[model samples]
Target: MFNLSYTKSFMIKQKFTIEVKIIFLILTTVTVVISLLILFFTTKEKELLITLGISPKEIELFINRVSQELILFLGITILVLLIILSILVKKILSPIFKLSLATRTVASGNLDYPIELKTQDEIGEIAKDFTVIERSLKATIRDLRERNKEIELLSKITTKMTTRLNSQEIIGLIIEDLTTELGYDYILVSKLSEDGEYSQDHIFSGDTQMKQAIEDILEEKIENIKAPVSKLPFLPDVSSGKIVIKERLADFIGEVIGESQSDAIQLMLGAKNFVDVPLHIKEKPTYLLLIATSKETITKHDKDILHTFMRAASIGLENALLYEEKTRWADELEKKVEERTKELEEMTAKIAHQEKMVALGTMASRMSHELKNPLAIIRSNVYFLKKKVPMELMKYLDMIGRAEERSNIVVEETMGFVKGVSLKKELANINDCIEEALRSLSHELKKVEVEKEFSEDIPSVLIDVHWIHNLFTNIFINAVQAMEEEGVFHPEGELIGKITIKSCVVNSNIEVSISDTGKGVPQDIKDRIFDPFFGTKIRGTGLGLSISREIIEKHKGSINVFNNESGGATFTVVIPIPE
Candidate 1:
């Protein structure tokens, strides 16, 4: 549109030009008519003026002056018209040039160029249309820039997700991008339990004070907040891969936790709107991405961007879960392989031990047969010499008898240990066997006190009475010897060592515990104490505990030793009770 003053001025200038032309035409016409009339009357008027005593020079002067005045008036009018026309043209051309310059400025990509047109003419109309085009171009460019930004953000997020395999790390990256890149006020990623019965916050970002306030209301840290799915009534639908948008932040929070806390949280967080997007892998939603913002409106473009982002996230999260599962399986398989290899090694060692023991057993049997007659003959002669020898020589004969006795005992124990004992099972009371063994070692126990606690409920068990008696005898002998070696007797020659034996029923087994007041077994060699040929004593056959273990095993029982709190060791033997 053109300006009013300029339109009026243009009209006035055109009217003035037309009037000037008209006036000039009328004057020229009038002059032509007068000349014709004067020509017609000039001859008669001139003669009349001459007859009336007028001169020829005066008449000529009058005509010439009248013609000059008319020509001068016409010249002044034409000059005035030319001046008005020039002003109108200048006014019209100035705006046209300005509009042209504006068009060029806009074409050069400067949409902010000012366009002002004062004329109400065709040029002004063109300027109006040009202003509209400039505004439209500015808006289109602005939209394009925003779209490019969203594309760049998606590209960066995709790159980051590719490098991260852990679900938590991927989640952290996503949250980081939303807050830092997209300028979100708060983000909460809640993971739904596999059973779909609970929703727990896995990661959170933004508004520390708001987070603290919500944490206080929930009585948990924001990240550790776990609430039942029933509390979040919309979770079932969300877990079904639905995206929920809530315009009222308070209502959203209320639905998530409770209405009592929603108002307070919304006030603290300055939240205006939020969106719940289900994060899925393999078509199953496992997480809910809650995005809250302070902006008054969340446009469709924002939702579209978020939707595209989550689709990529699902792929990343699925790969991450697979990687985690693969790692766990690899570790478990490695552990199983190691365990199987160790079991194989143990079996190989056990087989080698059995083979060596069989060879030793054969050699022991042969040696025992060869030495039996010599030992018998030596013992018989020693007994004969001890009686016939003089009083002074009786001590020497006694020493010989003791040496032969020790040699016979060594050969018997070696044979017993190498060749495993065969059980002659008989239903008998275990306390009776203990009593018999104690009776046989009475002479050695002269410096040791023996206490017994035999349970009244001890039942008859199917056991080899001979071997059971021998087992206790070996144990009692060892206890007695341990005390003797440590000089456990009192200075007055009184017995100080004590052996306490007890029997009880435990579970389906009979347990016998024998504790001594002597020095306990050394911890360093405790495990090897039951190994054949391993001993601490100077003259021990080293087969006592080993043979005892074999006898227990033959009876389908177990034997173990531990130090008593009192001072010495206690050997406990457990024999299963027959049903």
Candidate 2:
């Protein structure tokens, strides 16, 4: 069969034309040698046959035999050549094929993929060079990835630092970033005292006692060093407190810190390398950016990032200090303004009170003259009615007399509020005064329930008995008026009101508070309740409470009014006890 299958497989796989070229070369050389030998031997044999007088038929027959023999030998040679070429091509391409597969794998990012080509040829040399390049590229990629992570972390940090203005927050964020993102074991953000000493403000890691020992050591050590003031040509290197990173800290633990404390830190956190980047704040030279790592030594890139953070931190610190100062200033200004406001209010109140008293005095003095004439006419008419009227009409005369008398009393009290009235002083029982007021208003209190919470231990108040009587009467009358009425009958009637009178000796005063449960004092009218002639009642002049207040004030006492929680108004009168 005329077939060549193995060679076809090699062409599809390796793509090398070496086997085809070699086979072609072998076939061309064999054809050339055979043609040359046939030319020489056949020419000589033909000449010898002609010289031997051979027959034309025998020569033709001899040429045909040689042709058949040549065809058979060429066919055998071509078959042998194809077999040899297939074996050689397979042998050579095995290593090259493996290298090709490995190259594809390497291109796909499998750097550790082995190039198992053992051939010592040009192909092997190319594979060896490719392996070297892969190793170098792998290392480069790892470094790039590490750098990218740090840069991304830095980007986050930059965003954070520029965002908030709080110094403590920035410091805390910096410490957190260092520990969590950058892998630090210990960090401290300390402020230096005015006298050039370090104070540990925030400690991030390690055992408490050991860290404290280190802090104390740092403080003592910092105290001895020249403070890093800008006055110097170069800012002296301090620990994380200043720009100086002393060499001794890197070599061994406590030469710069303290032997025992360094040992403690080394044992506590596997911290070896340390970094001190100083932040210059406007307030003082006591600022520091102290950081340390446990596993790897702090790298140059880390230091660069730390330096940038320190600069931002310095700005943040100054801003916070300024903000604090501004806050203090604002607070002081507010306090002064409040005090001044209170003073102005008091002055305004005093002026208003004096003006009201003056106005009341003026009006009373004027009204007295005008009212006396009418009063005298009233008195004369009543006297005449009593004489002329029959006995049956005498009751009407008595009512007229009582009305005229009440009018006179109201006028007198209204005038008395401003012009000091002569007081009839007596050792009067306060409870008796309250009882009298209740008794006077008993007709109104018939529907209202009265409750008393009097303190038996209360000291007697120093007051004019007549004035105290008026005061209690005014309070009780107001209470009875404020009580809400429901109905006229018994069971269905819920007394729409209640009055609670409580008395107690508070400090140096006898305090009485009268609270009523009724529709609460209208918020709008509460301030005007004590104003003369400001009456809610459809009755005579509204002078009762004004006169009551004046009388209490005359006794060196004060009266306050407010809404009761349950409902209605509570009038509290505070009267000082008799010396």
- Can you list the residue pairs that collide in candidate 1? 2-119, 2-120, 3-120
**Which parts of model 2 are misplaced by more than 4 Å?**
1-63, 76-92, 144-177, 191-210, 219-253, 256-270, 277-287, 301-373, 383-392, 405-473, 479-543, 560-572, 577-579
Q: For model 2, how does the per-residue alpha-carbon lDDT over 1-579 read when each residue is reduced to its tens digit?
A: 112354445434554565456667877887897788678767877888788899978977887787688768867876787688678767776666676667656665677997766678888888888788889878988888887887787777777776776767777777777777667666655556566554456454434544654554445543332333233212224533444443334334333333444455454334555566556766456565555555555556767767666666666667776787888899999999999999999999879978886887788878876887898799899998899999999988877776775567666776676566667777766777888777766766778788999889875554577678778877776776666422224476656567899988889788899998766678898888787767777875688887888888878889989987766889999888876
Clashing pairs in 2: 237-244
Per-model TM against the reference:
0.59, 0.62
Q: Cα miss at 554, model 1 (Å)?
A: 2.9
Cα lDDT tens digits, model 1, 8-28, are 565557556755675576567
Candidate 2, position 510, lDDT: 85
Q: How badly does each model clash, as a count of residue pairs?
A: 3, 1
